[model samples]
Target: MSKRALISVSDKTGIVEFAGELVKLGWEIISTGGTKATLDTAEIPNVSVDDVTGFPEMMDGRVKTLHPLVHGALLGRRDLATHMEAMREHDIQPIDLVIVNLYPFKETLLAGGSYEEMIEKIDIGGPSMLRSAAKNHAFVTVLTDPTDYAQVLSELTENGETLFETRQQLAAKVFRLTASYDALIADYLGKEIHVTDPERTTLTYDVNQRLRYGENEHQAAVFYQTALPTSYSIAQSKQLNGKALSFNNIRDADAAIKIARDFTDAPTVVALKHMNPCGIGTAETIEQAWDYAFEADPVSIFGGIIVLNREVDAATAEKMHKIFLEIIIAPSYSDEALEILTMKKKNLRLLQLDFSQAEVSKKEMEYTGVLGGLLVQNQDVIVETPAEWTVATKTQPTATQFEALKFAWKAVKFVKSNGILVSNEHQTLGVGPGQTNRVGSVKLALEAAFDKPSALTENAVLASDAFFPFADNIDEIAKSGVKAIVQPGGSVRDQEVIDACDKYGIAMVFTGVRHFRH
Candidate 1:
């Protein structure tokens, strides 16, 4: 008896060649709808699925492949005597191979598809046949990706049959694809129908690129893109020039871009190292912002990533080329700027992205993979303003001091836990991040400011990502000549912290909001 292979796909990249090879190997082909027409057009011998079932397709082609003949052929166990007897009694031949791929639900959602259009795009029969075949992997070979065609054909040519291990691996891929496809559809419908929690939670990521290594050299890593579409994310960035991004490079780039987005009112610059902001500055002109930001930590900005909210000009590019940098990202670049920067170093990664539409999508749930399971929660996107703040100290901040306080509040969010940020009116003076204790972070930041006399520590204001535990942090800030502070004020010793601020004659404001990044 000649073996049979079911051929059905929405993506027809390599189907013709794949089917041709199978035909040359003496395998009977069964196809449905557009797939049948395609095989006929290519002059390949095939049996229409309608011919196998002896029934015309109904429900506008939706009912073509859902009949018992299709599923039974795929689900029948070749090793079971009873299953063989049942198949023989019904005159049904086993489907030895199943080639299937689902419809593009994700693509449709991104294309502004109508509700009705998207409803039609959700594939029913494709996933059904894939699951049936994958469930019976001991006897059937399944394929979902076009790239697997060559390997499958090669294996068949060598052994005259697909290997059991190959069948098992292909079966696993089918379930993965179908699960993600169903998850995408449910997420879309949940939004349309206003369902808070679907029956199951699903997140799918596609491998964007393979990195040389992870945070360390011995570990291997790869970058995967989430299903949601956003042009402002690092995945969508266009690399104008430079070496491929590594794990650390991508992490730093993401931190830099987020900080740059915080200061969209004017031209801003953020220089980051090891996932922490070393220098941040906002000014009327990008040139002045870069100068002030670089001056904030001239020693640490070496080989760091720099991001700006505006385009890069020739003068800025010339100054940037003087220093060793890992990456530079902006909205766009002047032709003269590109010519100068590209001419300076071939390994400098230059990226162009637009943050204008990043806020269009609502904040989605965030997840972290643990050793046993995943920890999921809503993203912390709560925004507050000075109008929603309280002046904890008797002395209110001056207008200039208030503006600098607001600037520091935004910049501090990007810093790691136990983080402290110091900034004068124009630029950041020092930043201490990832400390074990709040007082330790305060001391580090103060010492960083006084390291360079030009930092003007006496006139700077401090912002804390979280509330201070004791008055010790206040003592450290006052010793550095910082006269103002901003922090979330819900603490067991809030009065102690407030009394210390009053004792030092420092003005303080309680934002009633905390940002803790771990």
Candidate 2:
């Protein structure tokens, strides 16, 4: 009997050439619909599914290649006499190779296809054939990815058949592909029905990059990204220069981008280290923003990730080049800026991201994985204005103090829990995050802010991620000469905290919304 190969594909990349190569090797080709027409146009000898199954393709090509003759050929055990006898009785010719790829459901969903169009794009017969062939890998070869075509053909040409190990690998790939395909369809349909928390949930990601190691050198890690990447995401960023991003670099870059996204109204700069915002600044120009952010924490900014809302200019790049930064992310870079940044710092990763669709990007869900399960939540993208806050102190904040409080509130949201930030109108003076106690964070922030005297520090305002449980936090804030304070104001001792601010002549605002990053 002549060796037979089945081929059907939605992505027709290199399919004709692959089929042609198989034909040159004396293998009979079986195909369906467009694949069959494509083979015929290429003068490649092929048999259609209609001829083999004795059933006409129907249901708008949804019912093709699903009959027993096709599946039995793929699933029958060639080594078993019983299976062989049954195949002979049914006039079933065993299929030696199965090549298939599912319909473009993911592509359609990402393209914003209609509900009916998405439903139509889901493949039924294709996955069935793939699973059948994959199950009998002991006697059948399966190929779902086109990249495997060349290797399978080379093996067949040299050895007259694929190695058992090769067949097993291909079989595994088929199951993985089919599983991902099904998960994508299920996720899309689940959202259509407004099912936020289904009893069973499936998630999928494609490997974006394989890192040399994880946070530590001994651990291994890989970066996986969603099928539909968001515009403001670091995974979707285009690397223009420098070495491949490490696991830590990616994490810090993600934090930096999120913080920068919170301040889109002005030219903003965020300096992040170890997934914590060390300094953030918003100003009229990218250059000024860089200067303020750099001045905020010159020491911690070393080896940190820098994210900018506006394009990087030559002046900003020159100032940034003075530090031993790990990464720099920005919307774009002037030609001169790129040249300056990439000139000597070959290991510094430079990522260019588009923030035009940033508001849309905020709609994506955030995920956190634990040992045995995962946690899902909406991203913390809410922005509250100072006008919405209530004056919690007898002394209301001045316009400059209100603006400074607003900036501090925005910056503090990105900090770790027990967070405290001190800033003027345009730049952060100090940030104390992840402290064990609220007062500890307040002390750390105050100490840093008063470490040096500057005009900005004289009119500094403070913001907290959550309410201060005790008045000691207010006492600590008083030592820093911070003129205004902003906090969630939900603590039971809220009155005591307010009285302390009044005693110190500090203006305080209650936002009524907590922003605990942890």
Candidate 3:
């Protein structure tokens, strides 16, 4: 018996050669409008659906393949007496192979299309034929993705027939293709037309890759997305170097971007360890930012990821080569900087992300795993500049101290909750973070300010991302000889905290905002 195959697609990749090979193997080629035209252009003899159905193609080529002759060939069972009898009465023969891809529904949405554009792109006869072919997978073979074409062709050439397993896999892909197509259409209609369709937002996506593991070795990890977009999703990146990304690497990189993105000034640097900013500072030059950040905590930033908001220069590159860091996420890197960095740390992950173009589109409510389920809450602990802040303190900070306070406030927001940071002139002296008590956090911040008056006066400016609910914390910080103070003053004892600052002659300014990250 001779084989029969049908080819119809909006994407005509590899279809002509595929049909030619099948025709050479004594298989009849059946196709639709543009598909048939393509086969004709290739000088491959083909039968159009109109010729098979004994009817003219009508309604702008939409009614060509919806006739009973086409579907009966796909749906009729080969074994049953009643099915065989009905097929003979209708002059129908079983279709052995089905090659089809739907209209450009997904592509239309991605191309900034409107409702009418999507509605027009939805394939009616294509889905009808696909479902007809996929449901009879035991008898009919279905092909949707062009990537599967070469595999199917190779299998047929090697064995002279496609395996049942191959047909099953293609059928599954057909369902997935149709399902994803509808999800895009529904999602678009819901957004633009406000179509209160309850079925719209339920999204389904394909897995792109699986990481080495999740947060722990015991857990499993898989990454997924609706589509591969250039600046968005991990799958879109070209992994130029480094080992596979762990869960912690992605999390810390995300934190690094959040802090580094906002600083468009001369040079801003942030060193992140375990999803918190271990050190951060801004300066008139990139080298200065690197110097200040390195001097902040040369110990804690040993294996942390560093993010620089400005292009790295040779001076900064020379400084970075001495440290053992995981990754350096920056906007760009000079040739001299690259040469220096690559020589020292060849395996280091160097990523040049578009800081100005990327941001979290929506505030994803954070989900932390618990015993039974998970804890969920909004993550908006980002701190802003002092110019937009309301100063509730009696004594205001000096102009120079105000800049240091804003820099500290921005960095501390990325730190763990109950965190504190102390800095002066764009360099952190000591940072106390993740401590339980407020006073403990204060001590952790000012613990390294020095015993000598010269060192204390030169590099001691205390900053709290929040307010001091009591004056005792102020007295202890004064003992560290913090020459200035900056906080979001909202406590009932704000006056007492102010009094302590006056007694020590410490300049204090409140931004009237608190940033607590947990």
Best-matching candidate per lDDT: 2
Cα lDDT tens digits, model 1, 1-518, are 88899999888999999999999999999998889889999999999999999989998777888987889999999889999899999988899999998877888889999999899999998999999999999989999999999988998889888999999999999998998898888888888988876666788878888999999999999999887656777898999999999999998997787777667788999999999999998889898899989989999999999998888999999999999999999999999999999995999999998778656422656678899788887655666778889999987788878888888888888889898998887788889899999999899888887786743554688999999999999998888788889999999999999999999999999999999999
Report the poorest 10 consecutive residues by lDDT, candidate 1: 357-366
* lDDT of candidate 2 over 410-490, digit per residue (tens): 899988988999999999988899999888888888888888567769779999999989998888778767879999999
lDDT for each residue of candidate 3 in 1-518, tens digit (9 for 90 to 100): 67789888888888888888888878888888899899999999899877888999887766788888889999988878999899999789778899888888877777877878778888888888898998888888899877887888887788888898998988888888777777766666676765543531446567767778888988888766455243522434334346666777777877777767556665889888887777777789988888778777778899999988888889998999888888888777899888888884668877776555545522333546699765656656453556777554455667777767766666666667677877766766677778778899888777654522355247467777677889998888888767677788889898888888888877787777777877
Which of the predicted structures, 1 or 3, would earn the higher lDDT when compared with the native? 1
Clashes of each: 0, 0, 0
Please, what is the TM-score per model?
0.95, 0.97, 0.81
RMSD of each: 1.9, 1.4, 4.3
Tell me model 1's lDDT, rounded to 2 decimals.
0.89
Off by over 4 Å in 3: 53-68, 71-92, 106-118, 157-161, 193-200, 204-210, 217-219, 225-240, 359-385, 425-440, 448-479, 483-516
Colliding pairs, model 2: none
What C-alpha lDDT, on a 0 to 100 scale, does residue 409 get in candidate 2? Answer: 91
> In candidate 2, which residue ranges exceed 4 Å CA deviation?
none
Ranking by TM-score: 2, 1, 3
**lDDT ranking, best first:** 2, 1, 3
